[model samples]
Target: MITISVCMIVKNEEKVLERCLKSLKPIADEFIIIDTGSSDKTKQIALKYTDKVYNYEWQNDFSHARNYSFSKASKDYIYTADADEVIDDTNIERFVKLKKAMLPEVEIVQMKYTNQLQYGTTYNYETEYRPKLFKRVREFMWINPIHETVNLEPVIYNSDIEIIHMPVMSHANRDFKQIQKVIQSNIRLSKKLFIMYAKELFIAGEDKDFLEAKQYFQNAIENETRGLDEIKAAQCVLTKCARLMKDHNLLLKNSLKNFADNKPSAEVCFELGEYFFEEQDYVEAAIWYYNAAFETECELNIHYAGDYPLKQLANIYQLLGNKELEEEYNRLFSKWELPKSPDA
Candidate 1:
């Protein structure tokens, strides 16, 4: 049997610490928590789970903190999670068997992170695979001061494990002063890092931040060396920025035009649908929206694929007074393999 240690770095996470640790307790053999100057009961709560908790002064460099956490692990494998992330109860059994069944040759394990980004009563989700689990003794190392990830891409085992991120609804944790400080500290702006900088600022939900977000995203898109996924993501962000600024000209002309030039992505397709939908061009909008929901060779399934397009399609078909067409689309929504939204 293979042993797995769970490594985590936290600060002032008292609210969700117990929730995260509780779910992981049964699975992890070694729990290493590095608390970076928390004033809250986070350290005390961590001690309830393991005496492996240690104090580290707050550092703006995330990779350094993560490397410190990894260095304390004594198990064959290391799995990392955020204080706000929870492993699905359904995935626990599979995870255990996977731990035992994994071959020694496996260098890394990729698992999905489910981020539920809420907008009012409507909930939208975004998912991405990350190498959250890996062999502790391998040649793996983390990089980056913000949004750090392991550097090596050795033979990877794609696991069914999923971590659901449940962030508090309050704005207290929204401040990114520490991250900004690090960014301003002469960090080299790689394409991925650049996108994260923009995303963090854009998520701040201020007028000035949105403008900066637009500028950064446009710059990221123009760089041309980013991966397909990152480029697609930047395009989507630019589209959102255009919409927020109410710059319909940029939405229809600049943002969408730049994205369409590269590839046919579900994200750009969905935006096109919204563009035509607002103009009351139901026929054109429906065409683009259908591609967004059903197109297989999109930039990525999650890139443009979500419950939004399906919901919009049903609305459009119903608007056309075609009950039969609406039912056909409704069936697609009901039968979607991935988790569907409540109203979708």
Candidate 2:
């Protein structure tokens, strides 16, 4: 029966703030919100929940705002969430039970943030573990200007409680150009930063930016030292970039290199299927695609790593005039997301 404070920093989150607050209200003992210069009714909506609302001048650094919000928390445990995020009804009971059963030594509680579920949605998503719930200790401070992280002990306890994040609005980085400025000034020098740069480029959707992104990912892979996740993420990006760049040799090289590893990483199976398909090797390509659709697990940078391959297989079978295989995969893919009934 420990008290938990829900701490959050928000700006112009009016659209989804009410929904987020309502869902968290029953679970959290106290609400501590820091407004970062919202022109909208976000603050007005927040005040309905608690009087603990405080104002801070908008800072480009997210960690600053997050740290400041957590500082105001008076509870034993601090849980963080975004306006675009919600703890769904299915997990609410489990969440409360977990909170009640929490022990003293639990420094960080890692919950799955399902950015995208099932697949075939308007937006991309994957299940990622985030330390949203943590003990209210000063040592677990957040870091970084962008993609901020809290340094926590390796003793992370995974919780079954889940959170769904679907952005109701877009706050496209006003700081993208500034990040580029800092990168150019040599203020940031690291493989992580290069990965971030490549990510930004991948999001930009330009032909030239894709090529530049490939180079940045290449740099990350070459310079990184034994950071396996970072290297795998870079390879994930590079494999796709090679495909887009139409460099078949590079694609095969990287995909095979990925497959050569003891365990196949994210999107490698799908990429191999794509590579073989492009080489006009239909049988092998079908085998790879079938493996992707049914067998291997993926945590790829792409959203819907599970469903995307099945959809691709469905299309490939359609092109090959294999209606039996096409319909089977199409059924598998459609089972993920079904359109809502207008009346329901």
Candidate 3:
């Protein structure tokens, strides 16, 4: 059986650090904890488990801390874990079995990261595969008989083990601050970060947060280098920002751009529904809400398409004195569940 080192970077995690360590103790041959300026008893709790606890200054870069933690692992494989994660008894047995029977050629192992939707964070899915384990040292291999070439791609294995995520609070506020800092530093956000920023704003941002992000997304709308999806994401952010700020001209401009594409997102449709609803135009609001719930796909929060617009439609029908439609929409809203996949 191959040995495994569990490596983690933590800060002010005294509440959950011991619980996570106890759950992972059975499978870990060594524990490497890199504390990034923790004022709590997190380091003390970690020292009780292993002597590999080390302190690292907070660099505002999670990758740097993670790399430092991985560097301390002396075992055959490194298992990356977080303070908010836990493995139940059933999965612990599965992990032990995997360690004993894993193929030598497999350089990376993916495990199911579950319980995401419970916190209503940035993620849309409840469960998804994430790379959790990796071989500490890589071996280069030559392939092909005639023309020898080095194998570049790492062999990946998908495991059935599941890690339960149990965070005490949503990290959206902290993430927004970090994103703002990145933007203020004049660094261009990558396509992935741009999408994540937009999704987070829709999921958990308040009016002030959206307003602060207004200029950045407005610039994104005019930037020709961004892809179609990025443009749509930018429009979604700007539409909500405009609505919150009560800027009618800006709202119309962004909403019309989306309509011209013939593929408005559910978020934009819902914003328009809210705009009309506030103006007491019940009929127009109902039209936009219906389009949101039935016609368009959601780019950010799934609730905009699922329960959010459905609830609005029910309310609009009730205001319009249509008992039949009101009851129908209420029933649909109650039965609506978040889709397992984004495409669903």
Q: Give per-residue CA lDDT, model 3, range 220-305, as digits (tens).
A: 88999999999999999999988888999999999999888888899999999999999999999999999999999999988998
lDDT of each: 0.73, 0.72, 0.92
Model 3 CA deviation exceeding 4 Å by range: 142-150, 342-344
Model 1 lDDT, residue 113, Cα: 66
Best by TM-score, which number?
3
Clashing pairs in 2: 116-125
RMSD of each: 7.6, 8.2, 1.9
Model 3, position 82, has a per-residue lDDT of 93
* Positional deviation of residue 329's Cα in model 2 after best superposition, in angstroms: 4.4
Could you tell me the TM-score of candidate 3? 0.95
Model 1 ranges with Cα > 4 A deviation:
1-5, 19-29, 74-77, 84-133, 139-212, 224-229, 252-256, 259-262, 294-303, 339-344
Score every model by TM-score: 0.67, 0.67, 0.95
Better of 2 and 3 by TM-score: 3
lDDT order of candidates, best first?
3, 1, 2
Number of clashes in model 1? 1
Q: Lowest-lDDT window of 10 residues in candidate 2?
A: 116-125
lDDT of 2 at 341: 21
